[model samples]
Target: MIRLVLLLLLAAGPALADRPRDPGGSVALRVLEIAALEARGEEKRVAGDCLSACTMYLGLSTACFEPDAVLGFHGPRLAWGLPMTPATFEAVTRTMAAYYPPRIARRFLDDWRHTPRFARVEASRLIARGEARACD
Candidate 1:
C-alpha cells in the first residue's frame, strides 16, 4: 500500500510541475500571478537579478534563490513614477506586510523609509536571514 501511494504521488508530480511560467509584469500584477502559481503548487526559483517589483516573488510559499541571485527593494511610486508620497508609502508597506514574512516585511519597510534608492539584498544574506532558501 505504501509503494502504491508513493507511485501515485510520483505520477502526480509531473502534472504539478507542468504549470506555465509566470510572464513578468508590474508589482501588483506579479503579486496576482505569484498567487496563482502558488495555488498551482509551483515554486519560484530566483536565478538572476530580481529587481524592484520582481522582488515581490520572494513572498511565494516556495521561493528559492540560486547562489548568485540578487533582490532589490524600494518604495512604491505614483503612476507617473515619481517618489512615493506618504500615503503611497503606507500602501506599499501594507502590501508588502501582507505578502512577506513579518520580519522581512518590517526590514524592507524600514529600508524604504531610510533610502530613496534601490536597496540590494544578496541571496546569501537572504538565506542567512531565513528570508529565502538556497536552491538545490
Candidate 2:
C-alpha cells in the first residue's frame, strides 16, 4: 500500500538530477529541488563537494554519500549579512539540524549552527556513526 503511494509520488516529479554536484547556492531553490528529488523516491548519491544549502540533501530518505564526499555546513546568513529575527534564526537552525540524526543534530545545534566557519563532516564519519549509508 505504502509502496504504491510512493511510486505514485515518484511518477509525479521529474527525474532526479545527477548526484547533486555543486558548491551550493540559493536555499530556496535547493529546498524546491530537494522536494522534487524526495518525491521521485530514487536513490541520491553524493560524490563530490556539497556545501551550504547543498547539505540539505541529507534530508531525503534515499540520500547516500560516497566515503569521500564532503558536506559543509554553516550558520544561515541574510543578504548583505543582514540580521534576521531571533525566531527566524532558530527556525533555520532547526531546519538544518533536522536533517541529521539526533546525536549529530545536537552537536550541530550546539557548535556548528552559529559558527562563522564552515563545519566539514565527512561522509565516512557519517557512515561510521550510522547517520548515513555509504553509496554503492
Candidate 3:
C-alpha cells in the first residue's frame, strides 16, 4: 500500500510541477514570473488580446502569437491607477526598450508616445517586423 501511494504521488509530480502560476499585474513582478517560465522552457502563446503590461511577454524569445493575436502597448503609470507623469512614462519607456527589440521599442517610443490610448499591434505586423512568429 505504501509503495502504491508513493507511485501515485510520483505520477502526479510532473503534472503539478508543470502547472502555471498566475502572472501578477506589476511590471516588475511579471518580468520575474516570465523569467521563471523561460527558465523552465515554457512557451508563451498569445492568442487573444495582450494589453498593457502583458505586452512585456513579447520580449521573451519563446513567445509566439496566433494569427488573430492583438497586442496593445501604452505608457505605464502608477499602481494607484493615476494618470502618467512625464517621469513615470519615461521610466516605463526605458524599461520596455530594454526588453523589446530595437525596432519594436522604437515603435513604442516614437509612434505611440502621443497616441493617448493603447496602440494596437496585430500578429501580421509583428511577424512582418520580425518581432514575433505565428504560433503552430
Candidate 4:
C-alpha cells in the first residue's frame, strides 16, 4: 500500500510542479543578479547566452532586454571552432528560436561572429544563478 501511494504521489508531483509556474521571472532576476556579482569578482565569468536562452524559453519577454539584462545568445560550435554536442546546440538554438521571433532568433543564432564581449559576461551570469531557459 505504501509503495502504491508513493508512486501515485510521485506521478502527481510533476503536474503540481508544472502549473502556475513563474515562467522564469524570479529565476531570471536571481540569475542576472548573480552574474553581475560574479563578473565583479572574476574578470570574465559571464554566460549571457544561457540566460538569454532560458528567458526566451520561459516566455518572459517583459524584461528580455531590460537595462539590467545583458543580451547574448549562444550559437553553434561551428562559429567558435569548438566541439558542441549536437543535442545541446540543437536544443539551445531550438529553444531560442522557439521563443523569439524568427528575425531576432536568427540574428542571435547565426551572429556569433559579432557576439559582444558583454554577452559572454551575461551568459556567465545566467549560469551562476541556477536559472535556465525552459526547453519544453
Candidate 5:
C-alpha cells in the first residue's frame, strides 16, 4: 500500500505543478519561484489575476499568458503599504525591469510604475502591442 501511494503521488506531481495557480503576493518568494520554474526547463503558463510580485513572471524565459489574463504593475514597496526609500524603489524597479522585455521595461519605468494602484494590462492587449507573447 505504501509503495502504491508513493508511485501515484510521483506520477501526478509534474501535472499538478504545471497547473497555473494564483501566487501569494511576495517579492522575494516570487523571485525564488521563478528561479525554480526556470530550472525545470518546461514552459510555464501565467494565468489568473497576476498582480504585485506575481507580475515578476514576465521575466521568465519560458512563460506565456492567456489572452484574458490580467497582468498588473506598480512600483515595488512594502506589502503592508509602507513607503520605500527613493533609492530602494529605484533599485526594485530596475530589478523587475530586468525580467521584462525591453520595450516594456522602458515604458514601465517611464510611466506606470510610480503608483501603488495597479495599472492592469490585459494579456490580449499586450499581445497585440507586441509587448507580451501569447500562449500556444
Candidate 6:
C-alpha cells in the first residue's frame, strides 16, 4: 500500500525535530531538506539518521507524533495543496521568500497564489510586500 511506502520512507530516518513553532514546517523546507540529504547521500542508512529524520518530518501531518503515518498524509498534500492558508502555508513560502531573491520569490508566490486555496487577503499582503507576479 502507499501508506506502507510512506511509512518506510519516514522510518528510514530518525526522530524528527519539532515543527518550527513560529513558521511551522513548510513544504518547501521539506523539499529542500530532502534534496540536501539526498545530495549528501544521507538517504542511505549508512550515512546515519539525519536525512531520515528530515524526510520523516517533511512528510508529517501538521500535528502528530507518528512520523511515518503523519508524513504519509503529507506527501499527497504536498502535490495538491497549494496557496493554502497563509497561516498554514506561510512556513514554506516564507522560507523560500526569505532565502531566495525577490524575483524568485515573486515568481514562486505568483504561481502558488494562483492555486485554489490561496486567500485573497494573503495574496494582497504578499503583493504589497513587493512579491512580484511571475507574469507581471
- Top candidate (lDDT): 2
User: Least lDDT summed over 10 consecutive residues: which range in candidate 5?
Assistant: 18-27
In the order shown, the candidates' Cα RMSDs to the true structure are 13.9, 14.1, 11.7, 15.4, 10.3, 16.0
Candidate 5 residue-wise lDDT, 10-121, digit = tens: 9999977775657436677788889999999768787767776777778887889898788888778786888789998888788788888787788789986887587788
TM-score-wise, the better of 1 and 3 is 3
The alpha-carbon lDDT assigned to residue 124 of candidate 3 equals 76
TM-score, candidate number 4: 0.33
Compared with the true structure, what per-residue lDDT tens digits does model 6 show for residues 1-136? 9999999879864544432212224455656664666566552211112121132332222212221121111111344545455565656555444432355346546664345432212223323454322112
Superposition TM-score, candidate 2 onto the true structure = 0.76
Model with the higher TM-score, candidate 2 or 6: 2
Worst 10 residues of 3 by lDDT: 16-25
Give stretches of model 6 more than 4 Å off: 1-84, 116-136
lDDT of 3 by residue, 1-136 (tens): 9999999999999976664322225777768967997899899887667776777887887888876777777777667877877887788678866677788788888877567687888877888878787798
The lDDT for every candidate, in the order shown, is 0.72, 0.80, 0.75, 0.44, 0.79, 0.36
Ranking by lDDT: 2, 5, 3, 1, 4, 6
Residue pairs in clash, model 1:
none
Q: Which portions of model 2 miss their true places by more than 4 Å?
A: 1-21
Tens digit of per-residue lDDT, candidate 4, span 1-136 = 9999999999999876643322222333544654664555523222223344344532343332222234444443344466768787666556556655554556566674245432333323332443433121
Q: Per-prediction TM-score, please?
A: 0.70, 0.76, 0.72, 0.33, 0.75, 0.26
lDDT for 61 (candidate 4): 32
Distance from true location, Cα of 60 in model 4, Å: 2.5
Which residue runs of candidate 5 sit more than 4 Å off their true CA positions? 1-24
What is the per-residue lDDT of model 1 for residues 1-136, given as tens digits with 9 covering 90 to 100?
9999999989998975653323234667877888898999888788666766677777887778886777767766556666767886787667755666677688777676357776777778888888778998
